[model samples]
Target: MENNSIWVGKLKKLEPSDYTMSILPKLRIHEENVMEFLRLSASKPEHITEILKMENNSILIGKVNNLIFSDYAVGILPRLGIHGENEMEELGLLAEHFEYISEILRMENNSIRVGKMRSLVLGEHAVEIFPKLKICEEGGIEEFFMVTDNPENITEIFRTENKNISVWIRKAKKLRLENCAMQIFHNLKFQKENVIAEICLSADCPYHITEMFKMENKSIQIGKVKRLELNCYAI
Candidate 1:
C-alpha cells in the first residue's frame, strides 16, 4: 500500500491554527451552498426570514407577499453577498406582480364620475402600485405626479398666431406653451389686460400650462391639460 501515513504525518506537522485557517475558504463555500439549499426549500415566510438572517449577507429579502433584490445580482453577489438562482426567480415573479398591479391602477379612471364601488377598487389598486411608479418632472414642470402607465401614442397640437385663444383653451386640458410669443386672454375676449400669458426665453419652453375653469374670480382645478398620456382603456 502507498505510504498514506507519510502524508498524514506531514499534515500533522502543520500547526492546528494553520490547518484551521487553510480550510476556512472551503468551509465558507460549503456554508454558502447550504444556505442556498435552505432558501430553496423555504416554503413559508418564517422559514425564508430565518434563512435570510443566517445569510444576512444576501441582498435579497423574501417576505410573505414581496421579494426584494438588487438590480444587478450576478456582479454584486460574490463581492457583497450571495443568493440562489431560485431566490432570484421568486424575486422576479414578485416584481412582475407589482408592475401588473401598478398598470391596473394607472388605467383606472380617477375622474369625478366614477361610482363608489369602482372608486374603492381603484383606490386599492393605486395603493398597491404606488411604490413602483416612476416619477419625474413633466418637461421641467415642478408639479410632481406619478406615471404608472405608458401611452401607446403621442400627438402634438399647435395653434398659429391668428388662431383664437378661446378655441384652443376650450379644446386643451393641458398646454405646453414653450417657444411661442402669444398672450392668452383668460375669461375675456380680446382683452390683453387680464391675460394669463406665459413667456419662454430659452430654446426649450420655459413654462407649461394647464387648463382651469374660472368661477367667481377663483380658478377651479379641473384635470390638467399639459402633455397627457391617454390609455386605450380610457373612454
Candidate 2:
C-alpha cells in the first residue's frame, strides 16, 4: 500500500513500534504533531538531526537531542514547553554561534552573508565580509558590533539597515561628516581639513577650534549634516 494514499484521518493509528521507513517521511506532519513524527522516525537519529539542520524548529530540537543521546529509542514527549534553549549537543556538533546562519542558525560555510540571522557579534574579521554581504529589505544583521579604524568600514556597516550599530574607531585618517543627521562623536582624536556642515560642537570640544578649521582651500565634500555633537572637555 502506497503511503501517500493513506488518509490524514488514519495518522492516529501510526505508532513508533511499527518501524516503517517509508511511512514517516511521506506523512505531512504539523508542528503540534512533531513529537509523534519524531518518535516514529527515532530509528534514524541522523534523519532528525538533518531536518533540524535545515529548519529552525526551536527548543523542541534540543530536547529531542538530549533524549537521543541518552540511548532512548523514542523518548516520551511531555506537554510542549518553552525550554528557552537553542543550542543542541548529541555528538557534539552544535556551536554557540557561527559566522554564517540561515533560518536554522547552524554552521554553514557555503556563503559568508548571513541570511535570516538576528543577533550576531561580528569581530575584526567582519570588515572583509560586510562588503560582500547583500543588503536587502528582508532579514539582515539587526545588531552589529565592531572595532575598526577605517572610516570606510564604518560607512559600509552603516550602509545596511542602521538600527543598532556600534563602531569604535582607533583613529580616522580623514574625518568627513557632512550632512550627517543626529550623529554623536564621542572622545575622538580627529584631524581633518574641513567642517562645512551645520553642526553643534558641544562639551569637551577644544578651546582651540580654530586649529581644526585650518583648511587647505580644498572643498572636501562631507554632504549635509543636520547636527553633530562633539563630546569632549569644556570648549
Best by TM-score: 2
Estimated TM-score for each candidate:
0.17, 0.23
Off by over 4 Å in 2: 1-123, 137-146, 149-218, 231-235
lDDT of 1 at 2: 20
lDDT tens string, model 2, 65-180? 22111111121111112123321121111111222112222222222222332333332223323333322324333333232222333343344343222222212122222111
lDDT of each: 0.22, 0.28
Clashes of 1: 4
Stretches of candidate 1 exceeding 4 Å from the true structure:
1-48, 51-223
| lDDT tens digits, residue span 86-183, model 1 | 12211111111233233223332221111111001011112233222221212212211112121110011122322332332333222222111111
Clashing residue pairs, backbone N/CA/C < 3 A, model 2: 178-222, 178-224, 179-224, 179-225, 180-225, 204-232, 204-233
Cα displacement (Å) at residue 232, model 2: 6.5
